[model samples]
Target: MTQNIKKLGYFLLFTFVTLILYLTYLVMVQGEQLARHPQNQRIAAQEAGIIRGTIYDRTGTIIAETNWRGKQGERVYLKQDQLTPFSHITGYVSQRYGAFGLEASYSKELLGLTEADYLENLLDRILNRTPRGNDLVLTLDTVLQRTALNALGGRRGAVVAMNPKTGEILALASSPTFDANEIDRPEVWKQLNQDKLNAPLLNRATQGAYPPGSVMKIVTGAAILSQQILKPQDKIQCPGYTVIDGQRIKDNRSHNSVDFNKAIALSCNTYFALEGSKLSWDQFEDNFKKFGLSATPDIGVPVRSGTLAKGERRNLSQLAESSFGQGDTLISPLHMALACSAIANNGIIMKPYIVKEIRKPNGKPISVTEDSLWLTATDPEVAKQIAQGMVAAAKWGTATAASIKGLEVAGKTGTAETQGNSLPHAWFVGYAPAENPKIVVAVIVEKSGSGGIIAAPIAREIFSMALAR
Candidate 1:
């Protein structure tokens, strides 16, 4: 009996010690996170009292700042002088909803809570000086962003422009945007939340997903060339439609037998369908993954992955539709832009970056982020061939809509058909100055009949403006 009592006593002692140690560790390790819990109003109140850092553009234009009004108890965030022009990039920060965008991504540095900032703060404390939040400079060009936005003129679509060599997003514009200033108004917020047509809140550039249409042919061209089974000069016959497994797939325009250049230039559906079937569905899927279609870009923005429907290629008709960028493939404008950048940068794709540097209040660079390659194409030669084909597209193909005098632009246009009474989605993805690309632009117009007519024109205007700049 005494032994059993002693054993029970020892077990109780061990349990007590374990509980104490666990409590101590929790207090030491996760105490900060616990203290900053959403339910803790005290922490939020304290944060609301701090003077947040400013966000600037590449040209040193203030995009966002926190101003403390003497009359008001809390600090107010003025985004671009309380305007909504760059609201999406310089997202709003409210005590009620925490933070977002540059504010949220660099919150640690903005709040002087990151390790480096903490160390600096400690040093400042030792010297009896106040530690201030750091500023973030972005690669976004405000002039380009505004130009792209104004070019849309209330149209429902998106425009994304990136530096092809560095993958720095110069401009990202989504039309039907709302002003961030109205977010604090309950009545305006309720109206915005209820209105579906004026999905003014939607960030169409990254979040909107649509069937890539023929713009996907860029990927197809790369895949076919990489396999070494097809040559750039390969010839195929197009009889308006191709039949496989009793299914009939028709091209947008009828054409007779043509070579590879003519097939791509004319955007002949029948020719590509035949070529796509020869590659098989598995091979097509693998190549799609290789083109970054299976995953989203790591640009710290919300992006939807381009999807490929799962199934065996039963026959030529299915292959033809998929080859011409139809069937179950869907993609976002941002993803397509990056894919084009891959070809423009000679098979090497650089990861897209928005924020360029973080600096202390005194303008001392705390940290600088450099561009890095994200993916390399299966074959450098194949990329060159595709780039040539895209150049031909802008020169004499369906993307003639994007043809600008005195500029060699390589591009592809896509018109993806969908079910229902809605028109097909129009797409254009391309890069400027064919041999050495400086800018890559991807434009998408929802429910537009033809990519060449709808999306290409927008891209042309953007390219012209970009070159002029």
Candidate 2:
């Protein structure tokens, strides 16, 4: 009995020591995360008591700021309707609802909690002066964001545009957007959340995952080149229909005998189905990973990752379907745009970032977002070949609707089938001035008919406006 009692005592001692060590580690290593967590109301409440810093666009236009005149320390959005294009991103700063979006993402800096501001913050508090937070300069251009929003008017979809070389997001617009001010009204917030049909509060560009459809042929084409099974000039025969494992698959129309370039431009379902057969599903998956499709993108905010079918390809039928972006392959519009951006950027995918810099109220810089390479999508030569294929697509194929005068564009389109009797999702991804690419845009309209018809025109208008500037 004494021995057993001693053993119990030793176990208790061991557990107690482990608990102390864990608490110490958490306090030292994970302190910042805990302090800034959205659910941690203490720090958030304290920040609410203070005057939060202003937020601006890259051009120094005020986007968000706090009003001190109100007794309740009301956080006010400037030019409310004019800035609703930024609604989902600025989020609301309410004592009742706390902070969100960039407000939540940069909470610590907004609260003047950085090491550089520690002494100054302490001094300001001691003096009983207003504790001001740091300001944020974002990469979004109000003009571009407004253009994108205007282009998507009345459509239930999203648009994402970024610089290919720098990964600086220029515009991210989601239709059915709710004004941040709406959150101040509990009844309004409740209605927006409960409206399942429109989902005004949802940030569709980063969070909504959908079938990629034939726009995924760009990846399929890359997989073929990666395996060295097909050259740019190699011939592929498409008879409009092909049999894969006794399951008959059909294309939009017969593309006949065409080379690699024609297959991509025509989006030949049969050709990719055959090309996809050359690779095991593992090889196909490997190529998708090369384009960063299998990874969750670190685009300075929370985002949903693309998904393949739950399991490995069980049969050639599934593999062939996936090649044409059928079956269970799903991707966010941002993911598709970034992948296409890789082709525009000579095979290198730059890490996407929005918050360009955080600055002190005195105009001193606190932090600047750095540009870095995220992935190497393919060999330079292979990427160039695929880029040319996209050009052909814009010139003579389905994506002709996206071609802009006086500027060469490389593009691909997709019309993904979905459940119910509704129309398919329309998608378009492209980059312009092919020689010296400036902007890459991805667009999707849920339950819209054809990507070339519905989505491409919106992309065309954006390109015209962007290049004109």
Candidate 3:
């Protein structure tokens, strides 16, 4: 009996020791995973108790913030109640849905829990107090945003303006916008939820993808320039249409013969079709990808990854259609702005950035964001040639509608045809001060025909406002 008792005691001790070791391993190795588990409502509730930091524009304008209230003997930090019209940028913290936009993207830093935040917290603890959370300063300009909105005039479209040198998004405006104030309200939510034609919640500037139309000629020009398949002086004959594999491709413009520059300036489909056919599908796909046509901009916004279609050589007709911004080619306005950034920055494309800096509540600088290169167009000479073509387009080509009176504007216009009875989408992408650019703008008008008439003028107005500012 004494031996059995001693054996039982030893077994209990060993089991207890093993359990403790397993628990310690779980805490050390899988703590973060457990905290992020959906069942951990307590951790989420604690996060909700703390006041999230504010988001400001470059001019110190409060784009998004939380307002604390001591109402009915209860302390509440209301997010949607304080920030309206800017919800798309700030996003909302909902009880039902997880955080989004800047809120979700920068949660660690905003909540004072990042590595930098940990150091600051430790320092503050040693000093016998808590450090404040950091604030995000954006590169947006309120004036430009307002002007862009006004220019849209309730049209179904989007406008994106950025500093070419810095890749700082100055203004982003999407029409048919919603009021963030009504997000938590049942009635307003019902209305917004039901509406189909006017998707007030969609961020068209980054998420909306459309056929690029003739504006795609810019990429074709780049491909031709890079492959050395053709020279700027090389001419192609056009009878308003070209046939490849018994398929007819039409040019909107009726130019008999056009050189590379003239073809781009007039947006001649035949010229690009012939040049695009000379290169293999892989070559075409590679060049398009280089221009960001087949990629997504890492701007923290929900961006669509535009696609370039692939198929057999007999699909050359389909590929030719894509050369002029038709068929299976699609792109977002934000990506188009980046493309223009490449041209404006002399073939060096900078990554698009929104946040400029972060700071503590006491006004101490905590973090600052610097400009970074995203991609370089294959050849600088090609970008230069494209810039010259864009200059001519603004001066005497289809993009003349975008010409600013005093500022040297270089631009390209695109009118993409869609299936069924829908009107074509209008597109305009450009950079200003032709020789030395300061800003790049991309505008898209859904179901609005004639890029020269609709999209170009709006881009010109935005450019003019930016210059004046």
The parts of candidate 1 lying over 4 Å away from their true place are 1-43, 70-83, 119-131, 311-319
Which candidate do you rate higher for TM-score, 2 or 3?
2
Q: In model 3, which regions exceed 4 Å deviation?
A: 1-44, 71-85, 119-132, 311-314
Instruction: Decide which is better by lDDT, 2 or 3.
Output: 2
Model 1, 346: alpha-carbon shift in Å? 1.4
lDDT of each: 0.77, 0.85, 0.79
Please name the candidate that would achieve the greatest lDDT relative to the true structure: 2
Pairs of residues at least 3 apart in sequence or in different chains that clash in candidate 3: none
How good is model 1 by TM-score? 0.87
lDDT of 3 by residue, 292-315 (tens): 767777676678877777545338
For every candidate in turn, the CA RMSD to the true structure comes to: 3.8, 2.3, 5.2
In order of appearance, the predictions have TM-scores of: 0.87, 0.94, 0.86
Clashing pairs in 1: 273-320
Candidate 3, poorest ten consecutive residues by summed lDDT: 70-79
lDDT for position 168 in model 2? 94
